[model samples]
Target chain A: MSARRRLSLGERLVIAAPYLWIGAFFLAPMLLIAKISVSQSVLARPPYRPIFEPSDSLAAIWAKAQTFSFDAYRALMSDTLYLESYLSSLTIAAVSTLIALIIAYPFALAMARAPERLRPMLIGLAAAPFWTSFLIRVYAWIALLKDDGLINNALMALGLISAPLQMFATTGAVVVGIVYSYLPFMLLPLYAALERQDPSLREAAADLGASPAQVFLRVTLPLSREGVIAGALLVFIPAVGEFVIPDLLGGSETLMIGRTLWNDFFSNHDWPAASAAAIALVAVLMIPLLLWERARLADEDDAR
Target chain B: MSAPLLSIKGVSKKFGAVVALEEVSLDVGAGEFFALLGPSGCGKTTLMRCIAGFESPDAGTISLSVVDLSGVPPYRRPVNMMFQSYALFPHLNVFENIAFGLRRQGGTRDAIDARVGELLAMTQLSAFGHRRIDELSGGQKQRVALARALAPRPKMLLLDEPLAALDRKLREETQFQLKEIQRLTQTSFVIVTHDQDEALALADRIAVMRAGRVEQVAGPMEIYDRPATRFVAGFVGETNFIEGRLDRNGAAALVAEFGRIPCEPGDLPDGARATLSVRPERIGVAREGEGIAGFVENFVFRGETTLLRVRVARDIVLRAAACHGERHAIGDSVRLNFPPGAGTLLAEET
Candidate 1:
């Protein structure tokens, strides 16, 4: 009989390969960005280079050694345009997530309460948009929401607007685009959470003499908090870094951090400034992420 | 006679082609502990839902204190239901769960708190008020569910298999506690359960249901002593049936070739074929040469009693339960006897 052998080096490597790949491809790139954020920019034909040469005196090397510098960060904080764009992105993401939640909640509830035969169809309808390319969907929205697009044309033909209303190329258009793109992300989690909720809880609440509205607020909402939080995170996190929807539908009038970062990197060739802005966004995003993680852990503990 | 506190009159319900309940009618007296007992698919749940306004009957009306409940939503009804699964809100602690109903009626926060505290004390869940539903044991969850349902002090309360989730030992203990709580509150309680022992022990009266209709409704003892149908007789307790014909002797009795035995007619028409049912406990067993001779087909020695299956006649088996001290082996000759007034005449098989 063959003896049970210890795991081979090849097997161990296979098991650890995915993590290595992630570290190499994902974490390495991010660390590189962190390194470039503090380094001085060198202007050349390439329009960007590291400031310090390979060889220099110990003191001079120390002085030029990508030593802690807050110049890029200082530029991000003091610049009014960067500050405005950051604030705009935050507000737009927050408002769009909230709006998506409002729309998704009732839709999820209806799907939850629907007959078994109909549930799959309704859930499929909610999920169908996800199969398509998100960029393509945003482009489709641009076509529909533009000033001279189908929406304005139909409204003008119907005399709803005397002239084509300025719907696209604004903050409202950016929010609409974000909400539209991220709605399925909100719906799926909310649906999953609501579906797992036992109907007995609502019945128990009613039996306890709570009205329908009271049941929703007290039992339904609280019980579904995990899903709500998860759905919010799923939408808000991606919407914060969203670039395609705003670019296609929001036009130039909508100033956002994503657009600003894109402009800094590609247009102005300000690699250090772009990296600094990216780091700041990461820091801002981490606060909520940590809090959400703690809440999620607490919820899991409660479940156990 | 005062009017019944709750009356369900000729109520019927249908789900498409399926009949969930049919012509179900009953009255619950004030402070009565009524139970609806049946096997699964017997419409006890449908009837309970109808009373709670979760379901509206397709025909007939339900009234509580002469107030027609037609078109009344569950929230507007002065009734509550304790679901089979207890249905305690997982998100809310016991205190908030019990306080939910009171708060919804616009009660003052102090009033809600006081009532909830009182209920917690009543259900012996005062210390558990801050505990989440999942944190509770099965018995504690049952109590919290009861407290939550009763917190509103509705005119009537409904319990659907309230103790079904508890283990057998805990179930037996909770049955008495449930009865005591109902008595103490004096709120009309209509509990629905398929467990015959649970219904008999907890209910003042049990409505035995079969296939979407009530077969009989009577006090526990009466339902056991005089079943209204063959279904109720078989469903409620063990019985041995002897095929026979009605014997008119001023009083009715079943006359078989073996002997004549007195029995209740049980709505069986005169000259109709019927079977007389005698309880296994009531049938006497004796050794050969002691009484009517029969061969013991099988004997089971239970701790407290010995149950013997005897072939009294060709293809006719008679079950006899004897005290544990008696020993009767299989193939041993035994005798059987039916004590006076023990058998009940059942209607002819359809």
Candidate 2:
């Protein structure tokens, strides 16, 4: 076991490969997007070309000189349709996250207090949706909410409603879809957090003379705040970028930034505008993203 | 004198097929510090929980003064428990933690503040009110737990292995503090502990338990001096049990035989099979020519005293304690003497 042999090339490569892969797939793509955001848009091309110049001296070079412009950002701000869609997406995401949290908290609490023999089964039930295709689940919601579908059919058959209800293609339908899709994401983390909490703390609160409501308010809620925050972040961040459910369940009344951005890139073939919108969305989410990252780091620190 | 402040009658609790407590009954007099001492599987904690209203007995009733606690929840019970973990709420500061009970009782802000302040001062924790529970030391947390439990001024306080978490020196010091607090408040306290020294030091009376049954319930000195059963005698302290049979009849002194000395049993029924229990400190080391002779097998030095294990016969070891500076080395021959009435005869287990 010589020192040089102990420091084997294969072991070092095995340790360094994960960082390399992360840099190539995640960091490199993000940097490339940043670079493309500043480039001139090409006309009638499937993929937009990057505008770069070798030198500034020659006439040809000057003709092809890449001009850095904030015009795309200016276009993004000026477009009222894009701005409203962005705001609507943010609102939908926030509202759905709140609703998901409201539903998940009690479910998580019940799961946490359930007996040991029943705990794994409940957790599996909460997580079972994630194992199936998300798209199919969202599509299933369309059948449940559409006119002459299950809900309307049952309502009419029971004489609860005189006619079929128009539920699909509304903002409410989009919210319902997003909440249903993302609810399990909120629940798992909340359950994990609540389950790890010591039951002794509640006993201590009771012994200290706290009523049941006071115990939940003072001890249970505060102790589970980290989990609540984490669950909210998990549900909100992805829902803000979600387009599938909104496109399927929502009618023309739903104009989320995700669907609009997709239409801008694929339908309109406006790469610069789409890239500009993506950059703006990133900028809009920067503060929360940073806070969430900080929270995650703090969680890691506490674990260590 | 007055009726017991807290009384438990025929308390029997079972968890499915396992019986945690079986017809257990005890009374805690006002201002008395009582202890339930037993090993891990014993019903000490179960009894404490039953009194704290965390457990309900299937065949008995618990009462405080004259109020029956049949359907009372823990929060409504006139008793509080200091859990073994010192289960402090990690989210609340010390002041809020101590004020928790008072707030629940619907006290006004000023009233809660005054009560919390008084309890803080009483527990010598006035300066620690702003500190987080995790920031405080173990002893500090213990004091905070004590103050929190005492804030409501319940009729009785239950402690579950209160001093088991402390180091030896701290445990001894806290034992005195606990006794003093109990005296000052004049509140009945039922402490559950497995440590015999803790039980003996802090208890006015101890209920020794074994396998969900009360083995003996008596004052500390009485329980120690005259343990009613072999298990009680062995569990409470170190003792040497010598097999013997009652030799005499009537009111005459009962005598039993050892290997050499015809050991006179202190006082027991004649013709009964018994085991004589003698504390190591009660046995005296005699000079080589004075008493029944034995070979010293080992001598363990314990700072203030030396314990000598003597071989009186094949496979028979007798223990005697000698004070420091009056030394006896291992491998030396020694004689053992039992002063009159120093031994207690325990009935043989069925």
Candidate 3:
């Protein structure tokens, strides 16, 4: 058969679509940032050295590219500000994801145990937050947590406190914003896992002389490991790079990597330095997640 | 005689307005392989659950070893159930699944391992100890479930449709195996099954249930030969029901279109309506003029026996089974006769 007739046009397009999407959207932008991270900054348009000029010869371009260095990475290493920002960002993400898991686990369990007729309504309510803008939801937390906002007013009205509490512009506020915004992300996968569990297993455990607490500890908790892994990773990965919540809800002292990268790019106008920081953040966040993913997949293979 | 091992009296349960069980009572002997046999929604499972303490009856007392089991939870009850679905823990391997009960009771690691190992060998799952539950086939999983429940060595074991998941050949094999295991363990077994053959083959005594009540409880042979009600006779096996009225002589016989059928003696006013149930295998077939003439309707050639439906009168067809190789074609005339006391007279159903 001729080359064109070997494979149909429709089949070829279907095979190529996913690769094309990843190439155009993910690989190209990542490659651009990587290239910029190794270049030097200069007082010029785009503010980076060793630009790929169409008019230059290959030899000339190669000679100019030799000037590119790892200076931005070196700066990040020497400065404690960036180091502290990375550590604090990781800490905040870990803590917030843990809190979200705690809140979502019981909610998902309740949803799974609910009557069949009421389950769809329960799921829709858990997912209802997605209908509105995420930013608006975070902003709503600001409204509730403000010193003179609804919470304070209610507490004072109840005569439970002598004065309004200082609630906003703190690390607590940032954590609250993340947990609220990502609650659905943590709950959905957990619900899926818990809902799929055959309740007969629990009954069987109880029949085998395990108490309720024992059954939960030995069976229910261990069986939902996949959902726990997925939810923790989902919340942790995005929270590490979260910029909007920290910027809007956190006080001036909050120095997560996202805010640091934003300041380096927009405020300091240092594109190469920001790129270097982003790369460092990704590398640091990926190692643990990849290890966990490998372990989960190995478990799945064994189970199958 | 000693007191019954498990005694359930006046047990009644309702889910909202529908009665799941009503005034059910039973006394299971020690080490007896008792079966609760019924169709779906017939209160057999509900009754089993009540004994297991997964559910509490609205009114009644279930005493294990003469000790009141009221207010006791399933975990606290000295009974373990092999669920209909098996319900093997997917996360735990066979060894751990069997060891779960031992571990919960807090024994030494070595002791738990030894008991689990013994059970694995007992169930013929010795090499599958480390395999995950999902890796095992359906029959293998059933063994694991049985092993797990038996590991606890409770005073009693409740099995709900334990062989329902197996294919026909496997079910027959497992039926004998289950009976053998029960004999070896010497534990009072309450097995719930809707398969009447399974009940007959495995149970020492079977409780036939229908519509939230027990119709009769008797040995398998007794149940087959003398079912207390028409429903029992119909449900347990195929039988020909000859509807007729009692003779005016106050004798225990039914006069139908075929003729007078002698039945076991029962109290009935003269001319009262009654029925006689004759098992197919009990009826003999021979040549024409030797007995009542019956034209063969059709025959089903089962491997060991051929079941022939013979019409003796208008609207009165009797089923008779001949051994394999006994050829009888449809529309052929044959003679059919049963012994004098082969049929059992059934009271008019309430």
Quick one: best TM-score, which candidate?
3
Evaluated on the second chain alone, the candidates' TM-scores are: 0.95, 0.94, 0.97
Highest lDDT model number: 3
Stretches of model 1 off by over 4 angstroms after superposition: A1-15, A49-68, A298-304, B249-252, B264-270, B288-291
Clash-forming residue pairs, model 2: A169-A251
Pairwise TM-score winner, candidates 1 and 3: 3
Interface RMSD in angstroms for candidate 1:
1.8
Q: What range of 10 consecutive residues in model 3 chain A has the weakest lDDT sum?
A: A1-10
* C-alpha DockQ of every model: 0.63, 0.51, 0.78
lDDT of each candidate versus the true structure: 0.86, 0.85, 0.90
What DockQ would you assign to candidate 1?
0.63
| Clashes by residue pair, model 1 | none
CA lDDT for candidate 1: 0.86
Clashes of each: 0, 1, 0
Q: Which stretches of candidate 3 lie over 4 Å from their true place?
A: A1-9, A301-304, B248-252
- Candidate 1 residue B91 Cα shift, in angstroms, is 0.7
